[model samples]
Structure formats: C-alpha cells, structure tokens
Target: MASVYHINKGINRPIVFKGFVAQYIAYLAVGLVLLLIGFAALYVSGLSLFIVLPIILGLGAGLLLVVQRLSKRFGQHGLSKYLARRKVPAFLRFSSRRLFTSLSRGGIIQ
Candidate 1:
C-alpha cells in the first residue's frame, strides 16, 4: 500500500511572483505600464537612446526596489490597509442628522 500524503494550502494565501506578493505584483504591473508609456513617448519625441534608456532603466530599477520594499514591509494586505486608513477617517466622520435633512422648504425646486 502506498502512503497517503495530504497537501493543505490555507485560505487567502497571498499569491507570490518571484518574491513579490499579490498587491506588489499589481503595483509592479502599473509601474511597468507607466514606464513603457514614458519610454514610448520619449522615443516618439525623437529622444536619443543614450538619454532615454538610462532614465527609463533608472526609474524602472527604482520602481522595482520600492515595490519589493513595500511588499516586504507590509506583508500581503498591510499596504492596502495603510492606503485605506487615510480615507477611513473621512468616511467614518459622517453625521446622520445631515444625511437625511431637507435642503429647502419645497419638495422640489427647479
């Protein structure tokens, strides 16, 4: 009889790509798209490769480093939580009295 082995991956495991987790991949994708657009714009504007390449390479390297750092520092969901934290205060600061009030005496004024 062959031994039975069970493999278990917990729910909500963060997807990883070459050491980058889920949201980091999204950040990198957007960064790369912007980088490509910038490169294309530079090339279209008749900029020499000598000038354009270095700038693109530098920016791309910086972007990768930043994304990697953010991924490491924030684990999987911390970055999003950090981003949402700012908006949360404003969202929670709602007044119920102001929300259901009538602006004018008339029902509808055009």
Candidate 2:
C-alpha cells in the first residue's frame, strides 16, 4: 500500500488579505482600533457626533490609504530594509590610518 502526504501550499508565504500583505494587515487593524478609541473618547467628552464622526472617518480613510500605499510600495521586507538603510551613515569618518596600520599581516594588533 502506498500513502500520500499532503503539503501546505502556503508554506513560507506572507499572509495577505484584501491586498494587504503581512504586517500591513496588522498596521491597518491597529490604526482602526486607535480610531475607535479616539471616537469613543471624543464622544464621552461631550463632543457632538457631527463633529467627531467626520474627524474619525477622515482619519480612518487617510490611515487606510497610507497603509495600502506603503504595502504596495514596500512589499514584504522592503520597509524594514528602507528603515535600516536610513540608519546607516552616509560616510564613515576615519581621522587617521593608525587603526589600519596597527594590524599585522598575519595577526591582529594587541
């Protein structure tokens, strides 16, 4: 008798939902949660719904647009790469060659 094993086709793939890939989905969720919290706070503070609703709605729309644009532009790992690249210095400053000159051909300097 021969047996067949089933393999998951999605192995090692980034999770995608409605055009959101990987971390973007989490970003959107967190943004929405923050918007909800802001709405509730504003409402509890006695602000008119007419005032609060449009503000929250506009923020939510902006958040969605920004997150979607980032997801599309940066894909999965590009955003982290971009952020790390930003942290790198444009040029290293070496005052002198003494650090390099101290190194021996066969061994490191004490």
Model 2 lDDT, residue 11, Cα: 94
> Which candidate wins on TM-score?
2
Clashing pairs in 1: none
Sliding window of 10 residues with minimal summed lDDT for model 2: 101-110
Residue-wise lDDT of candidate 2 within 3-39, one digit each (tens)? 9999999999999999999999999999999999999
Tens-place lDDT digits, model 1, residues 1-110: 99999887766687899999987899899999999999999999999999999999999999999999998999888987888997765544555654435445444452
Off by over 4 Å in 1: 1-11, 87-110
Report the Cα RMSD per candidate.
Answer: 6.6, 2.0
**Most accurate candidate by lDDT:** 2
Total backbone clashes of model 2? Answer: 0
What overall lDDT goes with each candidate model?
0.88, 0.95
TM-score between model 1 and native: 0.68
Q: After superposition, how far is residue 94 of candidate 1 from its true place, in Å?
A: 13
